[model samples]
Structures are given as structure tokens and as C-alpha cells.
Target chain A: MSSFEAGAAGFVLGAACGAAGAAALALANRRRLGRFLSFAAHEINTPLTAVNMTILNFISGALGPVEKTQEPWLKMLREQAERLALIVGDLRDFIHLRLRDGLSMHSESVDLTPVLEAAVESVSWGFSQAGVAVRTRVDAGLPKVLADADRLQRVFVDILYHCRKFRDSGGIDVAAEAGLDGRIRVAFAYAGVKSSARESALALDLYYPARVRKDQLLTATGLGLGVLRLFLREQGGDLSVSNQPDGRSVITADLSAAGGGR
Target chain B: MAAKILIVDDEPAIAENLQAILSAKGYETSCAFDGSEAVAKARHEKPDLILLDVMLPKMDGFDVCRLLKSDPHGAKLKILMTTGLDRMGDVEKAFQCGASDYLIKPFGSVKLLQKVEKLLSGA
Candidate 1:
């Protein structure tokens, strides 16, 4: 080979090696971050659990009352204890996402309607507290989908959490249907858009919007959507969002029929 | 009378575990879960010392501490803020809000007992 050709080949080889090294480093960094987050979660979770329990016991009469002279101080201590637990829980969940590996699937044939209903029920208290109305539209004859029960529950939880964040007093609509390709599509629609940004704009590529400018939805960190996407992808499913002209946002998840087996 | 201690947090297992530990050490232990109820119980109980958590629903620990310290009736109570936040700012803020001292979470039983003993002795 000519010297020029030899040099060109050498350059190509060098570039390939460089790329491989970069990829390896990235993977290592990611794993390290995951481990760090897991450790952090444990640290926060343990104390949070303790703090939460202490408060519960106090209220339940497992611990008796404070004296009249010390009443004001005791009350303040109690409130602060509860707040600490909330912050710790949020931090732990967020860190878990950062440190988690891609979703680990354990699929089985499952009636998804009940799962969705449970999701709705789980958040009903928060919805009522926030004054939001929730509605459902599961097809009567919808086929059971193969899915990881835990992950599927998480998907619904994410959607419901988003709906609760954005809309107050307005109604949320959840509907499921069978697609022509033997896939099941579940959609969550709220009456108002938290943002006018198109569904594509909500793509996972972009970090959650810095601020939710839309009036209808509560401000969200978008971490929930990111985690939901990971879960869906593991089950051979995909999640997408669309912005309707009437200022509504519809989030849909499509799951393959193959996802139903154990 | 032995000094009574109130521990306010939201996690049940932690509370139960700690109750066992402290009760064995001969401290009269009481617990509470949320801010609103914690306040109610404190007013009723008047614990000798309080182990307070910083983050809470309805009201936060700082505000709770401030409310208590501001009240003449509650001003004498010794408040020790306990939390997982190790940030210097959080510690400073806790002290600024009238917390007598601060303890980081995941503390060993020995450390907790030691701190409790110190606070009780000082009081």
C-alpha cells in the first residue's frame, strides 16, 4: 500500500479505538452513578422511615401527650419530622431512577383493566384532595396484555401523577383499545393542556421543561415520564404524548401482544 | 420524675424500633406522625425533650421550631433537630430556627443515646 493509504487506514483504526474507549468510560460512569444513587436512597430511606414511624406512633397514642407548658414546642417538632420524611422519599425515588438499569421485564398474561383501575384508585385520594375529577374508558372486551405487573402499575402511576399535577377540578379521561396490529393502546387525556408545546416537544430527548407554563396542569419535573418510558420500552412497548388543539395533552402507551407471556 | 422525650417522625417501623431502643434505656418515649398532629400532641404532652425531623407535611420543621420557640409556654423545651440533610446550610438554619442542636440521620444507637444523655444533662 502507498504511504497515503497506509496513513488513512491507521487513522481509521485510531478513530475506532478512541470511540470504543469513550463508550467504555461512559458505561463505567453510568454504573458508578447508579451505585452512588442506590447508596443515597438507602441512607435517606432508613431515616425517613424512622421519622415517619415515630410521628405515626405519637399520633396513635403509642406515645402519650406532652405537658401543657411544652405543648407549642412539641407541635413544631412533630410537623418538621413529617416534612423531613417527605423530602427524603422524593429524593430517594429520584435517585433510584438515576441509578436504575433498564427495566427488567417479568411478563405474564394479565387483565390490565384492573391494574389501571388500581392505579386510579391509588391516586384517587390525592385527586380528591386536589379537587380533580377522574374518568375511565376501558373497552369492555379488551384483551389481556403480556406485561410486567409492577412496571405496568408504575406506568399508570406516572400518568395519573402527571394528570393530578396539571389539572385541578377538571376531569381526566383514561381509555384503552386494541390496535390493528394486536397491540393494546392505553391513553390518558386531560381536559386542559399543561403546556401548548406539541407532544413531540415532550419527547424524552429534552429534559422536563424548566417550568410548566400551561395553566391547566401542575408543574411537573418530567422524571415520571422518563421512568415510564424505560418501563414501557422493556416490555416491547412505547409511550407517546400528543397535544390537542383544544389545549389538551394525551399520553398513550402501546404494548405488544407478545408482552403477555410469563 | 425522669425526663420525658418525644420523637416526631412519620415512619412506623423506625419509630417502633427507636421506641424499643429508647424504652430499654429508661427514657419515657412518645411519638407523632404529621405536623398538625405533632403540634397538637406537643401542646398536650409537654415532653421534656423533642427529637424533631425537618421535613414534614402541612408545616415544615423550621416553621414548627419557630412557632414553638416563639411561644412563651414552649420556649423552655429542648429541641434537637434530626435529619438526613448534612448540608451546612441546613444545620445553620436549624439552629437559627431555635433548635438546640442538630443530629444527622442513620446515627448509631450509641451516638443517639450519647446525644440524648448530653442534652438531658445540660437541660
Candidate 2:
């Protein structure tokens, strides 16, 4: 072969080799980032867990300091600790969902009734202390949802928590009904101090789960509204919000019911 | 004469917090700072239950659990894997090695005591 043709052939081979090398490096970086996130999340959890538990002892009256002066401060500490703990948990789940394949991580046939009941149980003391009643009407024998029971409980608990936080001297009505479109819809309806964000909250049908882009993940962190929706979608459901006819904000999540491995 | 519990964790804050709470509940509580320390304490102490952390220095929680489970004294001991690694995969691994129960981090007083009570009651 001529010198010119030989040089051209060598250049083509070198370009291919460089492209392969770059691809390998990108893959390695992705794996390293995942490892770092996992380690960070694990480390953060230890101290956070200790602080949260200390607060839990107080909240449960284990400390025996029922002084009237410390009531407000104790409540605030509990709420903040709960919030931080939730964020760490949500971050861990997000990391796993990002690093792993998808819903296959925790997908299973889950009964929604017990999950909601547990969520309600978790926040029962808070609701009672705030004089906010909670009522639930989960239909019997409702088709199970193919989702992670833990995350599903979190969605319900987190939703109820917000309602209880922003409550306005009334109660919460949680009703679950089997939807006609191969789904199970659970609603958390409450009447709270109305705000300007009411409309925007309903209009926030932004992260649809199916289209969870990488940039979207970066933007959505902690236990934000977007994160809640992402968790639902990650389990093959969609979250929507609508104002009740009685002026209450109703946050509804429709998850695909577990039917024949759906 | 309450049951004894070994709190195994690398973090002093977590270990002490748990130790305080368990002691307050009338259970005899001991502390171990790492996986190896945990094994040594379990072997010598022969506690009724152990609140074992997943991550530790020198040796990790899983290895400690595996080691204890194989020991004759720890054969029937109740091991509760307590850690921040709340993922199902990790939980399953602990269970595979014979964990009595799994409790995630940041647990409340009620939850922790309830689990401890149940475990001691042989549930």
C-alpha cells in the first residue's frame, strides 16, 4: 500500500480506539459516582439517626420533662428531625433507583389498606396532639398495587404529614377506590389555611416518572413535591392534585394495581 | 434482672444514644465500637439480644453477624440488624445470615422499645 493510504488507515484505527477509551471512562465515572453516593448516604445516616432518636425519646415522653416551657421547642425539634430523616431516606431511595434498573428494585404485590393504616398509625400522635382527626375508608379487597410497600407507605405518610402540618382545625379524609383504568387511586384531602400556591400545587403535574431525565433527578432532591411524585412514578404510578369542591386540596396518587403481574 | 442487649456501632453518638435508651428501659446494655469488638463482646457477654450495626471499622456488621451466628454461644441469640442501610437487598442479606429482625436508623423510642420487648419475649 502507498504511504498515504497507510497513514489514513492508522488514523482511522486510532480514532476508534480513542472513542472506545472515552466510553469506558464514562462508564467507570458513573460507577464511581454511585459508590460515592452510597457511602455518603450511609455515613450521614448514623449521626442523623442518633439525633433523630434522641428527639424521638422526648416526643414519646421518655425523657419525663413535661415542662410547659419546653413544649414548643420540643415539637419544633421533632419536626425538623423528622424532616431531615425523610430527606436522607428519600435520597437513598433515589440513589438506588438511579443506579439500579427501575421498579424491579422493590416492586411487589402490596395491599394498600395496611400500608395506609401504618402511615396513619405513625402520625396518629401528631394528629391527636394538634386536635386534627383522621378518617380512612380504604375499600375492602381492593386490588393490590405492584409497588414497593415501604415507598408506598412513605407516599401516604408524607402526604398525611403535610396535611396534618397545615391543618386548620378540621380532620383528614383518606379514601382509596379501585379505578376503572387498571389503577388504584388514593386521595388525601384536607382543608387547611388556603395559600396562593394552591393552584400551582394542582398544576404541578411535572415529573411523570416515565420521563424522569437525569437533569430532572439533579434538580429534584430531598423530599420535595417533585421527589414524592418521582417516588410514585418510580413504582409505576402517577400523582395528581385537584381542589375539592369544598375548597380542600386533594392530592391523589394512581398506581397500577397488581393484576396478572402488571 | 432484665434481658441484656449489646449495642454494636462504630459511631459513639449512636452507640451511646442507644445504650442510654436501652438502659433506661431496664435492659442491661453494653457497647461495642466495631464489628470485632461486637463479636468479642457477644462471645463473652452472651447477651439475650444484640442491636448490631451494618457498617463498622476493622470488620463490617455482616461479617460480625456471620461470625456470631456460627458461634455455639450465639447460636440461639437474637440478633437485630440495626443500621442506615435500609434497602431490601441489605435486609435480605442480614436475614439470610439469621437476623432476628431489621430496624432502620432514626427509630423512635416507642418503635425501638417495642421491637426490643418483642425480641426478648421470643417473638
Q: Which candidate wins on lDDT?
A: 2
Docking class of 1: incorrect
Which runs in model 2 stand beyond 4 Å of their true positions? A1-3, A99-104, A120-136, A158-173, A189-223, A241-250
lDDT of 1 by residue, B11-55 (tens): 656656667667877889999876776777777898878888776
Q: What share of the true interface contacts does each candidate keep?
A: 0.15, 0.67
Model 1, B96: alpha-carbon shift in Å? 53
lDDT of candidate 2 over A50-86, digit per residue (tens): 7878877776777666778887677777766766766
Quantify all predictions' global Cα lDDT against the true fold: 0.69, 0.77
lDDT of 1: 0.69
Clashing pairs in 2: none
What's the CA RMSD for each of the models? Answer: 15.3, 5.1
Error of 2 at B9 (Å): 1.4
Going through the candidates in order, their DockQ values are 0.08, 0.58
Q: Which candidate is the best by TM-score?
A: 2
